[model samples]
Target: MPHLPDSVHVMTDDTRPHTATPTTEGVWSVRGTRITADRTPEGLRLRARAGAEGLSRIVLRWRLDTPEDARILGDAWERGYGDLQWRTLQPDRALPWYALITGGAFGGPTTGWGVRTRPGALCSWTVDESGIALWADVRSGSLPVLPGEREVDVATVVTAAGPTPFAAHEALCTAMSPDPLPAVGPLVGCNNWYYAYGRDFGPDAVLRDARTVVEYADGHPVRPYCVIDDGWTEGGGSAPGGPWDTGLPGVFDDMADLAARIAETGARPGLWFRPLLSRTETAAVRPGLLRDSGFPLDPSLDVALETVAEDVTRFRNWGYGLIKHDFSTYDVFGRFASHSPAELALPGWSLSDRSRTSAEILVRLYGTIAEAAGDAVVIGCNTVGHLSAGLVRVQRCGDDTSGRSWERTRRMGVNTLAFRLAQHDRFFTLDADCVPCTPRTDWRLNRRFLDLVARSGTALFVSVDPAARTDRTDADLAAAVRLALDGGTPGGVEPLDRLSTTAPRRWRSGAETLVHDWAEPWGAVPLAV
Candidate 1:
C-alpha cells in the first residue's frame, strides 16, 4: 500500500505567533511549506517530531486540576528524588528528562487524571478561572522532540476563564456501544494486576500473603484471578540505583501462590507484565535461553514467558485455571535520552530508527506472548489497541487514570474510549481499565463516569487494590461490577447532547450539573471553546 503523501501533513496555522514574548517558548520548523510547532503548553506536552514518516504527536496531558491534591503527579515526576534521567536519541546527543510545571497549565476546569516520566519532558500544574491541576509526560523516540528549539503553544484569549481539562474548543467523537450491556452474564473475578505488578513497591501491602488476595475474590459476582504488575525481577522504581523493592525472586512460585489464592476465591488469577520491554544485561534474564533477535531484548519473550508456562503446567498438575496476561505500552515507547545515566538499551543499527523499532518490536512481542500464554486472559495497557486485537482477550483501552477531579472524567479516559470504539468488540473484550478500581470516596459521581466508559457491553473486569477498600461504600463498586459482570447499567450509557465539533461524540457521565461543550466535527477549530 502506498503511504499517504506529505500533502496530507496539516499543521494548524493559527498556532503561530506574529511576535515572540519572553513568557512564550516553543519552536516552528518549516518543511516545504509545512510548519511544525513544537511548543510547550505550560511545559505540559511531551511530543515527538517525525523524520517525515512517523507519527507526530501533540500530547496535551490530562491531570488533576489542583496543586496540593496533585501529589499523585509528584509520585510519577518525583521532584525531590532529583531529576530522573534516561536515554533519548541515544548513543549520540543524549537528552535528560525532567518534570516542569509552567504554572497556569491546569487553568481549565474539572477533568480526568494520570502520569508518566521522561527527561526534557515536562508536567504543568496551574489554575485560572477553571480549577486546580497537574499533568506530565515525555515524548517517545517514535517522534524526535527537538530540544532547545522554538515551539508554539496555542493561547486562546478567553473572555471567561474555564476550569475543564478538555482542550479549548475540541470536538468529541463518541461511539455508544451498539450492544446492550444489560444482556451479559453474571461475573466473579480478581482485579488484573499485571505480571510486573507483583509484591513490588515496598512489599505487597494488600496481597501480602498471595493467599489473601485469592481469599477476597471468593464471593464477588465477577471472578478475576489475581494479576500482578511490573517489578517482578531484578530491580525497578525510579531507575536502578534508587530504592528498588517489589516482587520476590521466584516468578513462577509467586504466580502459583497467587493462582492458588484465586482458586480459593472461586476466581481466576491472572499475571501482568511489560514482556517486550526488558534487558538481557540483568541477572533476572536467564542466560542463553533468549535468542539474540537483535531487536530490543524483551526478557519475557526470552525467559519470563517460559517460566509462566512451566508455572501454569504446575497449576495444571494441581488443576489451576487460566492466566491474565498484561502489557504496558509506555515502556515499549519510552523517551529516554541515550546520554542519561539511567538509560536502558534499545538495540539499534542506527540512531534515528529507535522509536520506530520499539513500536515494531512490540507488534512482534504481542503475537509471541499470546502464542505462549495459551488461553490466558491477556490484557494490555499503555497499549496500542489494534495490535493486540485477538492477541489478548482483553486490552486496557484507557489509562488506569483515576482521580477525584470531576474534569478527569472527560480527559484521557473518554478520549481513548471515543477514538478506539471500533475495536471495542472487534477481536476481544475491551477493558476500560480500572474505573471502579477507585475506592468509593465519592459514590454517585464516581460510578457514573466509570459506567459510561463500560460502554459496548464488552466491559471485562474491574480493579481496585485488594487493599483498595473504601471508607465510603462497596455499594457503588459492587453496583458497577454487577452491572459489568451481571451485565450492565439498566439503560446503558446515556450520552449527553452534542458538545463538540467532533464526530461520534460523547458526554459520558457528567457531574449532575453537567454543563459543557460538545465536539462538532468539521468544527471551527481544535480547542476553540
Candidate 2:
C-alpha cells in the first residue's frame, strides 16, 4: 500500500493559515496556489505553485502508526552543523532533510522519512505522538513567496524500511539523490587550514606542505592532493572576504607557478577561494549585486554570478586540478547553519531577486561554479549537500575540526562522520573535514581518526603541522595515506554505536569491529575555538 499524507496545510507571511481545499486524490489548492503530490516507486514527489498572495510554507501531515517509544535520528543543515544522534522524540526539534525511526514495535527494521535536498525550498520534519509533519519552507528569505503562479519544485519525500537503521538511511539517501557526481579517484590529500588557518603561508610554505603529502603517499599510483587553502588571494591573511582575481602581491606572486611547483612534487595541486565574497570595490561589484552594504556578493545577481564564473575559470587555467570553494551558504544567507534557526536563513532580509527562493539561488550559484570548473574536481565547503549533489564531486559533510582543541573535533567531526556517513557517495564523497595533527591536539586521538577516515573510503585530508610530526606520527600518516590512495578498506566502514553516542566509539570494518577511546583523562571540555 502506498503511504500518502493525510492532510495538507499552507501558510503565508507568518504562521497564519490559508485554507487548502482538496481538489483531487493527491492535489490541494489554496487561494491561487496549487500543490501536487505524485506517488513514485521509491516515495512521493511534491511540487507547488505560488499564488499572488505569495506562499510561505506547504506542510504535509502523516498519521503515526509506530510505537511511541521509537528512537529517532535526524540530519543537519549543511557542513559544520552537528549535534546528530538517535534519541527520544523531541516534538518541536527540526530534522533537516531526513529523519529515521527505529526500535519499539519494529524489532529489527528501521523506518526512515527523508525529503530530497535538491528542491527550491528548505525541507524539515517534526514528529510527535500523533503524527509526522514535513514542512517545506518556500519563503523567499523570511517573507512569503511572491513568485506568481510559476510551479516550484518543493521536495521529494522518500521512506524506507530496512533491516537496520544504517541500511534504511542509506536507501532513503539513494532515493533522495539519484545522480551524484562521481569522485575523482581516491580523495586523500593534505589541507593546511587547520594548522595554518589562512595566515603566514607563502609559496614556499605551500610547496613544503605539498612535498610532505607527496612524501607520505610514497609513490602510490593515485597522487595525493595538496590544497593551498585560503590566504592565497589579494589582501592576504585570515580575513574572510576576497578579491580572488590575483595572488597576494608579494607572497604569492604567481599562482600558476605555485601550481606547477606543487605538481612537480608528484601531488595534485588544489586551490581554495571564497567566491561569493570580495573586498575589491569595483564597477563590476555594484551595490545592486550585494544583499547588504557589505562584502557578500548576492548570488541572485547575474553580475555577481559572472564574477564567480570568471574567478573559477581563472583557477582552472592556473592548472589546479581541485578547487575547494568555501562559505557560499554563509555569504548567501549571512549565517552558518549552526547559528541560523530551523528556517535555515534569518528573516527580515530577502534576496535582490525576490522571485526565486534561497534554494533556487544557491542551485544556480553551484551550477555556475560547476560549469566554470569544467574538468576540475569541485569540493564544496560550507555548501548545502542536497543542492550541490550532482554539481560537486565532494561535499564537506561536517563543520571544521580543531587543531587548537580536541573537544571541538570530538563534538563536530566525530558526530558528523558517524551520522552523515550514510550520505557518502550516495550524495557526494562525504568529507568529515580534516584530521588535524598539531601540537595543541593529541596525536593518539588524531591517529585513530586518521585510520577511520582512510578506512571509510571517503575523502581523507590531514593537516600535518611540521612541529607536530614525530617518528610515530609520520609512520601512522604514511600508512593511512597509502591505504586511502588504495581506496580504503574493501568492505568500507560502519558506525556500531551511532544510536547511543554523538561521537561513536565503535565501528565495523570488514570482519573486524574496532573501538577507540575519544575521551582524554579529564573527559570532554566545552567546545571552544
The candidate maximizing lDDT is: 2
* The 10-residue segment with the lowest total lDDT in model 2: 285-294
Query: Which candidate has the top score in TM-score?
Result: 2
Predicted candidate 1 versus true structure: per-residue lDDT over 461-480, tens digit per residue: 44454454564435555554
For each candidate in turn, the TM-score is 0.47, 0.96
**371, model 2: CA deviation in Å?**
0.9
Query: What tens-digit string does per-residue lDDT give for candidate 2 at 1-529?
Result: 2266888889977866666888998899987888999987646888898878888898899887656787888777777455777889878888888878887443246877887667888888888777888888888777777786678888878876678889988987887888888768789999998899888889888889999999999989999999988788655545456667678888898899999999999999999988887775654443644433347787888988998999899999999989999888877777778822578777687877778888888889999999999999999998988788899999998888989888878888888789888899899998999999999999989888899999999999999999999999999999999999998999889999887888889999889999989998998875455
**lDDT of all predictions:** 0.35, 0.84
Over 4 Å off in model 1, which ranges?
1-222, 231-253, 279-329, 336-361, 403-410, 436-444, 453-456, 460-472, 489-529
Per-candidate clash tally: 92, 2
> RMSD in angstroms, candidate 2?
2.1
